[model samples]
Target: MTRIAINGFGRIGRSILRMLLTSRAEDGFELVAINDIAPLQSCAYLFAYDSVFGPYPGDVRHEDGAIIVDGRRIPFHSVADIREVDLQGVDVLLECTGAEGGRAEVERGLEAGAGSVLISGPSDVADMTVVLGANEADLGAHRVVSNASCTTNALAPLLALLDSHWGVESGHMTTVHCYTGSQPTVDKPKANLVRSRAAALSMVPTTTSAARLIGAVLPGLDGRIEARAVRVPSASVSCIDLTVQTRKPARVDEVNAVLEQAAESPVFGWITLPLVSTDLRMRSESIVMSGRETSVSVGGLLRVFGWYDNEWGFSNRMLDVAGLMAAR
Candidate 1:
């Protein structure tokens, strides 16, 4: 079994734990340890009762350093810094610590003896950045990997598939995402000036590097994409509106049929399901393309819509990346 440790207990970190525990036998992973700046009880409590994913679907109880859940007694290590935590026999550290998962912090996990390290969020020094279905070819014997941001997870596969089939000239993506931990519950003076306002009560527009990040996964598309985001007051689930200017103009039905065919391909995981974000609240698939909303212009512009449970699907993809790296 691939022994794993989670270095952060934020949304992505804890969600990964949930996926691993829920699919342990099928995925062949062993949960060894969890490291976080939060106290053991707080972390355990949060794990036991999450506001977003709802309560823990399985048994989870802890007495200090160790917690029993999903029929496993995993030890929890509370630490202000990942270097301070000791994870014995860890095969991979899913560094889901968001901003804390910088290049240096990831190095600490490597020094602490993790066989490999994969950032659950974006990181600068990860040897590879993979969007599982879109670019599994990028996975190799790299010591560090980045799963990229959740939005990147939603956009990369769609763009990669479209670019391959229709020859994309350029594209624009707007992610309509739900508010995350980085935002405040109420308005305040914050770093990202615009996001300083209330997270729950406002639909804030912000910049995203997902377009630029995808270049690493799909080099040919570099400098050819524009991306942005709007954080609305929803709990979870996100959608991406992609306008692709194809190399040659195609009919609406023709463009959609391409996506429909791509959906049949297992590698891309593009499902042409006629569903909205609410329909995908607890779903696992990364991109659930809305066949009804997919459209093509007379001038070769294709507008495609896709939805995903950002926390769940992205976490599952991260685990998929972990499994691939472990096998290599």
Candidate 2:
């Protein structure tokens, strides 16, 4: 069995762990250890309401600097110094800390003898940044890989589709991203005063690196994309708005047809067709990719919408890439 070690127990990290436990039983991947500086009780409390696992129905006991989960007895390691943890037998190390300190963490994992390390957030030092189904083929053994943010994954297929079918001239995107843990629920005085306000009541402007990183996955799109972000009240699943200038002017129906075709392709089963506004209102929380319809102007511009469960959905894609690496 392939042993996997997960670093960080944040939202994305815990979601990835839950996903592996739920799906990897038949895939030969064993989640061996979870590492975080936070106390085991705190970690357990955070995941207490996990929809699938419900609550952690086990006691957390300390053993050899690791927290053991009762019954399952999975070790949750707490290492003050990440560099000292041994990962000699770990096949894959998933770093979901979303910290700028990713480079150091990844380096430590590689030095500990992990065969490969998959990062869930953006990092400047990874061997390559991968978007599952878009550029996963670029990953290989004994290398560090980073999965671009969920917004990037949500936009990649669309960009790839346009570039493949009708050449994309240029594009702009604005993501009304849902509030994340990084934002506060109530206004407070903080060092980073800009984001210190409550996200639930504000529409805060922010910067996004998705456009810059998306080009890495699709080289043909270099210097042709730009993005801006807004923090909204929603807790999960953010929305994306894209405007693209196609090589040739096309009707709304024609563009929608291309998206529908791409979504139906075996390669992009995650992309779903356009839905009516009423339909979306009915299943607002369903894990469907939004933006089935398109609005094409007389010019070559086309606008589209895309939605994703930033945490669960992106974690699913990350796991898919990690499993692929494990298979090799």
Candidate 3:
């Protein structure tokens, strides 16, 4: 089994642990150690009961310096610096901390004994950024890599598929995203005024890197796509509203048919039935396209709607990338 060490036991970190425990036999990955600033008891409690994912199905307890899940004890270290953790035999150190100085931390992980590093979010310093199906081949001999952002993971595959079948001219995406830890619960001071309001009370407009990063994955379409975000009150799940002008005209039926064939993969899903955010809670597909919501104009303009569990889907991709690295 591949030995993995988590650098941050936050939302993504805990989600990864849950996935490993639930599918350990099939996935062939092991949790060797976890490093977080929070105390072990706090981590254990949060893992046992999550607001979004609900209570973990397995028994969770903490003793000595490890969190025991289903009788398996994984070492837990509470530390501000990852260099202090013993990552001697770790195959990959998952960097989910969203640290601003992530480039430096990647080096620290390499020096601290980890064989490689996989960042949960985008990083300029990463050897490369991969969005699973869209750009998995781009992953090479690099030791440090990024899984990109959740929106990128959700949008890139769809765009790539569209562009492949009918060349894309230009596009714009607006992500109706759920509030995250970055925003405040109540009105407070923040660098971004729109995000300062209560997260559960307002739909705040902001910027996104997904549109910008698509070019990195599919260079032929770079400089042709733009994206923005609206932070909604929900705690999980996000929607992507994308409009693209294709070189070839397509009918609505044809577009939906293509997506339907692509469904059930780790990177994409096709939903024939109507559904809401809460219904998507633990659905593993990175992005699910609603066939009922697709529309295409005679003039080669196409609109697509997609939904994703921001944390769950992205966590799955992180592990998938880690496994890819291990296999190499």
Candidate 4:
């Protein structure tokens, strides 16, 4: 079995942990260890709040700093000193921490003899930044990989489609994303300049590194894309709006057909819904991929809209990519 370790226990980290607990048996992977700066006793409460495995999924218990699920006891430890733990047998170390701390976590995993370190969030030190199916092949020679942000992952397939079929001259994207744990529920001053404001009652304009990371995944798109982000009040789902300048103007149907084909492509197969929307009621939260695919559409002026459950959707893709890498 593939032994895995997780760092951090926040929204994405906790979701990744739950994903592993529920998916490992089927995927031939196992959660060997989990670390966070927070106390282990809080894990039970965190797990209870997780939408994926709310309030303990099946025969789960917390005892002696470990979580027992279906007779498997997964140990939890403090991340303050990651070197204290023996990760020699861990096949993959998932850094879902989303902190600048990720760089240190990857270093520790390498020192502990992990074959690969897969970061669930963006990181500056990763050997390569990937958006799963988009540039997964780039991970072949890398020991440490960073799965670009959820917004980037959700938009990659769509951008690839446009570039392949209509051909993109330049593009701009804005992700209306749900508020994360890092954001405050009420207005408060934070260390970061932009995120210091409250997320509950405001739309926070922020810059995104997704565009640069997207360029890494699709080298053909270098210097052709720009991105921005907005932190919204919703807790789970997020949406992306992209405006592209095509090399030559094409009919709306032609654009939709291209997206539909890319959605069916094995490499970019996550795009499930392709349509044109004139309804103002089309909401970011209402969009979801019921099947193993993504939703996409062509709006006026070569614009497109895509939606995703930032946490669940991206976490699912992370595991899928990890599975493929492990097999190789």
Candidate 5:
């Protein structure tokens, strides 16, 4: 079994742990340790009873400095530095802290004895940024790697397939994302004026790095994609509104067919029925293409919609990448 350790027991971190506990029988991942600055009690409570995912299905309790799940004792660490944690037998350290400490943070995990470090978010300094179905083939024998961001993961796969099949001339993507922990519940002080206001009270327009990061993952479409984000009031699930002008004119049926065929794999999903954001919660696929919403303009301007559980799907992809790292 691949022994796994998690840093930053927040939404992503906790989601990974929940996935492991629920799918341990089939997945070869073992949760050995967790590192977070939060108190053990708080981690336990939050893990056991998540507002978005609801309560965990099995036994959950905090004993000593660890969170025990399903009778398995996993050590938890509250540390100021990543180097302080013992990763002796850890095959992969899922760095979900959302820290931009860059190279220094990755080296600390390796220096502390982790075999490999998989960052949960985008990292410019990491050896490679993998977006599972999009560019996981680029994964190599690197000590540190990045899984990119949730938005990037959702966007890359569709972009890859479309660009490969019909040829992407240029594209603009707008993600309707849910409010995250980064935003405050009520009006508060923040660097961005829009984000400083209430998080769950309005749809705040903001910028996203997914478009810029797309160039890093799929260099072929580097300068062709433009992207933005609007943070909605919902607590979970986000959908991408992508409009791309294809090099060749294709009908809506053709576009939907392309994604439909790709959906044969577990990495992608296809939905012909109308569904809400809540229906997408806990969805394991990186991106669920809304075939029902696919449309093409007279000028061959292709538009596609895809839904994703930003946290759940990305957390699952982290494990998928971790599995590859462990095998390597």
Candidate 6:
């Protein structure tokens, strides 16, 4: 089994742990250690109960020098610096600390004896950026591999299918994203202006690096895609609205057929359902094309809607990438 360690315990980290625990019998991974800056009490409480995802299906407590979630007795260690953490026999140490993860953070895990480090968020210094269904083939032998952001993962499969079928000209993507931990439940002191306002009370427009990150996974889209995000009050699942003028006039049926074909290919993670955000809470795929809502305007403009359990799906993709690396 591939021994794994996590360097953070945020939404993504806990989701990964939850997935691994639930799939222990089939997954080729083993959770050996969890290193985070949070206190043991905080980690215990947060891991056992998630407001967005509901309580874990099992009991949780601290025992035997570790936090036992359900029947798992994975050891936990709290440290101030990444370098201070230990990963003696770990095959992959997930750098789940978001912006705090990059080459430097990954190197710390390697120095302490991890076989490889997988970053759950974007990193400019990582060996390569992987968007599973799009360009996972771009992976290299380097130790640090960033899985990119949740938005980027959601965009890849949809964009790839459309671009291949109708030839994308230029695209504008608007993601109606749900609020994350980065936002405050109530208006409070924070930077970056609009985001500081009450998250549960307003729809806040924001910028995104997903467009730029897309080029890393799909080079053809380097300068052809622009993205914007609107943070909404929804607690979990989110969707992406992609508008594009195809190089060729796309017919409605043709577009539906294209997505339908992609969805049939399980590896691409496309689903042709008209489900809403809440319906996608525990979905494991990176993106599921909402065929029922997909439409092609008479003026030759194409609009595609894709839904994802942002937290759960992104974690699933991250695990897929790590699993690939482990197999290699």
Q: Model 4 lDDT vs. the true structure? A: 0.70
| Per-residue alpha-carbon lDDT of candidate 2 for residues 74-124, written as tens digits (9 for 90 to 100) | 678777555567888888788877777746756888887788888887778
Encode model 3's per-residue lDDT on 195-239: one tens digit a residue: 899999999999887967898988988999999999999999999
Model 4 CA deviation exceeding 4 Å by range: 51-54, 102-105, 191-194, 265-300
Rank order (by lDDT, best first): 5, 3, 6, 1, 2, 4
- Each prediction's number of clashing residue pairs: 0, 1, 0, 4, 0, 0
Model 5: how far residue 101 lies from native, Å? 0.9
Model 1 Cα RMSD, 1 decimal: 2.0
| Candidate 2 global Cα RMSD | 4.0
lDDT (Cα) of model 2: 0.71
Residue 109, model 6, lDDT: 80
Model 3 vs truth, CA RMSD? 1.2
Query: Per-residue lDDT for 271 in model 6?
Result: 54
The predicted structure with the larger TM-score, 1 or 2, is 1
lDDT of 6 by residue, 23-130 (tens): 544778788888877888888899888998889888889864589876668888888676676778788888897756445656888898888888888888888888
**Clash pairs for candidate 4:** 270-293, 270-294, 271-294, 272-294
lDDT score, residue 110, model 4?
A: 74
- The global Cα lDDT (0 to 1) of model 5 is 0.91
Choose the strongest candidate by lDDT: 5
TM-score against truth, every candidate: 0.93, 0.85, 0.97, 0.84, 0.97, 0.94
**Residues 158-211 of candidate 1: C-alpha lDDT, one tens digit per residue:** 888787778889989999999887888888889899889889998999987696
Better of 1 and 5 by TM-score: 5
lDDT per prediction?
A: 0.80, 0.71, 0.89, 0.70, 0.91, 0.83
Q: Which residue segments of model 5 deviate by more than 4 Å? A: none
| Prediction 3 TM-score vs. true | 0.97
